[model samples]
Target chain A: MPDTGLLLYGGAFGLILIGIAGIVLSAHLVRIIFAVALLEAGANLLLLLATWHQGAAAPIIVAGRVPDLMADPVPQALVLTAIVIGVGILALALSLALRVQRAYGTLDMHEVRRHMEQDIADEAGIDMPSSSHAPAAVQTARQESGA
Target chain B: MQRLSSALFLLGLGLLIAAIFRGMEFGTVAPIVGQAINSAAAEQVGAANFVTAVVLGYRGFDTLLELTILFTAATAGGMVLGKRSPTAKRDPDAGFILQAGADLLFPLLVIVGLYIILHGHLTPGGGFQGGVILASAFFVPILARPGTRMSHTAVSTIEGLAGASFIFIGLLAMFGGEAFLTPLMGQGELGALLSAGSLPVLYLAVGLKVGSELAGLLAQLSESEAVD
Candidate 1:
């Protein structure tokens, strides 16, 4: 019989794989951030599951009766910390994506990368012959602005 | 082509995970750390909840570092999404139903969050969980009134003071002839609210610090969105 442990491990890794697939296949920056979130959620679930036991109750103490089987408290503590930190990092990622969208006018990863490279090249004063690049409009505009 | 590669990678990863999962045992008893914590936590820390003892007493230093990580993330997020000029347009307000719902639930959420944080020594919830609840409570208003910004100054001060006070309490424990973060006063009867002494106090500091940090993160994200 398949137990809860097997299900948990399977579920967590499944979510992680899905997240990785989303990150790799999706072009939109926002979807990529969501994929990152899925990855974090999977990791959090895995961390929490690592401490589970067969008959263990939650680590909370009742007034009179002492629990015979108490779940491990350390992983709960660790995962609590991870969840908060996950929120922080995800928010950071979202804000960065927002900035990227505002700057480039598109959320497509490829386009953003091309624009970012062009910006860097412009900043470094490297003259990239513009004939080969597809987004020549952005490059030509940069040239026209003398920026 | 891109989707094909991603699918191939995912299949490989899943295979690896399945292989790894097969080795792990299921339905086992608790680990050694849980046993030790359960046995000694009552006598040593005087906290009824072993989880609380682990978080606020045995592993207090790690909790402090966790708070620091949260603080650093908040600071970095604020820097990344710095204040925009006043001319930046605002996000549209939420609809009346959503706004009203948020307003109605906000106070209830705050109270529940406080209960969780305050009763952490005796219950399942603790500083980090309660703090997140409190932070979510604060976020309701932002959803209701799109342009309203949280006070960065207030949030920063709360965060800084709470972190400082956590360290200070640990120092006080050190002065009381115990190791750092050792419960200072006498551990009262188990399951009592004030029984855990420094444990509850540390939890309170943690709750405030985490709540403010998360609320600040939300506010900064909203502010950046509004500017855009």
Candidate 2:
């Protein structure tokens, strides 16, 4: 059986891998946001594990008794700060996603990207580059125009 | 082809992480500062929880900046969400069970949150953890009754005052010829509630600031008009 350290490390890394995979593979904006959160959580865990000791107690003094081996307080403090920041970022991301959904009427990543590109092109007063996958009629019309 | 490339990328990332993990020497790195703090924190900061001491004492600036970050994010989120349309329909009240549960949970959560915040220096819980519970205390009611709006004025007022008081307390320490955020007042008895000097006051400010900011942000998110 793997040691507890190995298991804990594995879980953290696993969360990071899954989060990255979700971000890369998922096509929904909300899923991507959630993946980002997962990645943040994994990173926080990894940070806390950086100063891990085998038999360390929490870094707290109880009733004038100090433990022989106490966990590092710095990383725990840092992780606490990081977690709050993560929640703030997540809330902002969700709010942004809500706004995007309101503006474009869809949450599908591809559809949103397409709409964004079209909006940019329109704003720039330039025609969008025609895709090879354009409808046959549209392609024929483009060929006939030759402009 | 895209999927294949994505899979290859992920596999490479996993291998890289695993390699780094294996290379790291766990349980061996000397925590020099941590050990020093462990020994000296009781006399210096007088907080039973060394983590709280480190958070609100040694690294108070970092905590302050973190609060600023939270404030910035909440403000930007609120701006992006904008105001709800006057005629936009609100979600109907939740079922009987949820309404009852939310009501039942409110006072209990507030008490627990305050307890955590008050005992932050003595135990594991602190401003951020307790603040989240306090936020939920307000947010739960909004979840149950969408028609009832939180008083944004009250939330913003609490948030502003709490944040100001945090900085004000830090400045107070500076007035006494100490560095910014140096814990003032004599370090009282270790492991006592009234000990830790200004740390608890700072944490009280932190908890209230975080609680109000989060509760307001959540209310804004929930009250926004639904996408058709």
Candidate 3:
């Protein structure tokens, strides 16, 4: 029996929480991208909720008559801008993901990270960090040497 | 052990957010600027949609900056996804039904997109929504017929011109002793198609710029070689 406001706020917060969990928990690049999108959507909804009013009509004049109560227009305009920006960022992210997949031949985040670290170390002409999840042989060798 | 930590961290985060939410008031804040804009938008901008007035008339510069961001993202995306090799295998054309459906939907989408954009001042939909539709209109055809390449040169040209004209219109207002992007010309009769002074023109430019930019970006993404 929660009121409309509580329900809306709950939905927005739930979306945000889910999106954050997705971003933090998912290892796949595409999943991460989608999570980012979900987070953006949740944020947009929260923003729109900030100015919510009960029984408010859309902020449009029809037939030369203004309604008794009109919803806030500024937030709507801001949300429109945010949405377009989100789309642009998503497209860029996907393209970058595509490049990363092509370059590394894998989309798994941990594998990609390992490859990238290796590449960077190699470029720097330094040995790979022992702390990294390198091969079992390398780990054993480092452990034996330490012992 | 990792899962346990992650779950604990999420629980803490959720509790924190819930605590924050509990203290805050909802649906009660007075929208000072919104109320002011709603009262004055009709006479000042002559647009039925007050949101449109705020977008193209009051906060036009923000819209312009948004367009720039979209342009930058699209350009960087294109750069990231470089030229598809001539020898790379392309996705085969879709089935006959899909191709036929695409052909059927193309004109309808274009018409609807244009209607939404042109009637933005009086409707719920506006440049951004309509522009996405327009983009899909072009992109759907490419999805159906992979061989039919969209002319990147033409898209870029249209995008550039549309973006320029948006700025040009704003600058024209500056010449007439007003601030940038100030809605010019007669406000005309409210609710009429041609009534919103320069707002409709601004939206037209926005719609075209967004549509072309998106279409080109999509085409580039589709053309890139699929990673195995």
Candidate 4:
């Protein structure tokens, strides 16, 4: 069973890595968010199972009750913390997605960037040689505008 | 591409499992878990469950952060879905059988959740498990009646109070010349439910806090779409 649990544990980890890969490779922000959530869940379950890992005994300490499955609480603590953080990140990301949707006509990152460039230039007065030099132009503008 | 992604995911999962097994092989994690459960002083933590002890006592700071995450998530979820009056109403089409069944299950869940929280000193489960169970019970109601709007103020009040109480107990112990959360009162009753003095109280607070926060999240999610 240790082998089996290890297999389950390994499988969960693999899913997590894939989910993370999905997040990184995907073009869609929502897909990325879903990927991230899947990663988080896989991670959480893995942590919980760690409490049952072979090397560790069950968390129960018994006078005579017979100690069984004993995985560490430290990881559980860490995972709990991670889960909370994940929830906050999910919510914050969701709201940001909403805000972005409101600002731009679409949620596509590629399209939004195109629309944002014009807004950026308007708000930031481009005078440099090219679009690539927009940062330097903005810096010069800021200095010209003065504190 | 779909098949490829799935395959890659499975491979990564396999490696991750290996990592977990490798971790178990290290033997560092088990000793600590076993000892905490077997401690003679376990009863003082106000819990009957050892897992609860680790969660609410020996390593409570982690739990604190977890609550913060839930609270923040609930609040953010409110912000997202609450921003717009979503025309996406709750699907009122559930068969009466499913809805009624959930209603019956609610009380049982509540009892089990309470059991989990209360036994957290001597057993494996703790306030977190119980709290989530309680929250699920609440979720059922929201599912049944999607129009229900949980009072944000009330939820926050409960969450804040319970959280403060956990810390306050810790502070009290500190004042009494014990280390933080060092159950100032009881001896380890071993298998008894009420043996772990302050632990039970801590678990109580945790359960209350978790239950309320989760309920609030469900309430927000169930309401009309958040957009503005």
lDDT of each residue in A42-128, candidate 4, tens digit only: 888776665455554555666545455445556665675576567667866876776677678577755665567658877788742
- Per-residue accuracy of model 1 over B92-196 as CA lDDT, tens digit each: 898999999999999999999989999889888878889999999999999899878899899989989999999999999888788888887888998888887
lDDT of each: 0.83, 0.92, 0.92, 0.69
Which 10-residue window of candidate 3 chain B scores lowest in summed lDDT? B1-10
Model 1's CAPRI class is medium
**Model 3 residue A90 CA deviation in Å:** 1.0
| Interface root mean square deviation per prediction | 2.9, 2.4, 2.0, 6.1
Q: Chain A of candidate 3 scores what in TM-score?
A: 0.88
- Greater DockQ among 1 and 2 belongs to 2
Candidate 3 lDDT tens digits, B1-228: 445667888899999999999987888878888999999999999999999999999999999999999999999999999998999987888999999999999999999999999999998887898999999999999999998899999999999999999999999999999999999998999999999899989999999999999999999998888654
What's the true lDDT of residue A42 in model 2?
A: 94
Query: Could you tell me the TM-score of candidate 1?
Result: 0.88
Candidate 3 is graded, for docking, as medium
In terms of TM-score, which candidate is stronger, 1 or 3?
3
Alpha-carbon RMSD to native, per candidate:
4.4, 3.7, 3.2, 7.2
**Residue B165 lDDT in candidate 3:** 99
Error of 4 at B174 (Å): 2.1
Return the candidate ranking by DockQ, descending: 3, 2, 1, 4
Cα error, candidate 2, residue B1 (Å): 1.9
Each model's total of backbone clashes:
0, 0, 0, 34
Best by DockQ: 3
> Which runs of model 2 end up more than 4 angstroms from their true locations?
A130-147
